[model samples]
Target: MLRTVSYHPVVRALAAHGLHTTVDVSRTYPQRRFTDERDRQYAIAAVRALFGDPAGREENGRFHCLHYESRPESR
Candidate 1:
């Protein structure tokens, strides 16, 4: 059996400490498992909510990637 884990809470904690994060989504997982595009989009939305906005994004084959950098210190 395959189990799924969520890292959203950990990502949020990192963001709160001004750490950088990168998220990568793909249509397939190890062992030939697959995921829907809608699910990937939902993940993107969730990450964006925590990290604000991605500093970079890329699409490689069936993979969608996002990079989030620590925000600059406010004046």
Candidate 2:
């Protein structure tokens, strides 16, 4: 069985800083109310293609997932 994973708020906070969010992976890592299977898969593939290793996990009442980091100077 899959164990529940913790959601690191810092991860979401950082993703937000760059206009990105963990929600981007709904397809590959489906959870209640977050997204449907199709979207999740699309998101997963999209992320993998872009970031090489996209994060996908669950915690609390929500699902946490991978996010890309912005360049130092971009922020």
- What TM-score, computed on C-alpha atoms, does each candidate reach? 0.31, 0.29
Model 2, span 1-75: residue lDDT tens: 111332346556665666442333434333454366665565455544544343534322233333333333343
Query: Candidate 1: TM-score?
Result: 0.31
TM-score: model 2 vs. ground truth? 0.29
Q: In candidate 1, which residue pairs clash?
A: none
RMSD in order of candidates: 9.7, 11.2
- Identify the leading candidate in terms of lDDT: 1
Clashing residue pair totals per candidate (backbone < 3 A): 0, 7
Q: lDDT per prediction?
A: 0.42, 0.42
Candidate 2 Cα RMSD after full superposition onto the native fold (Å): 11.2
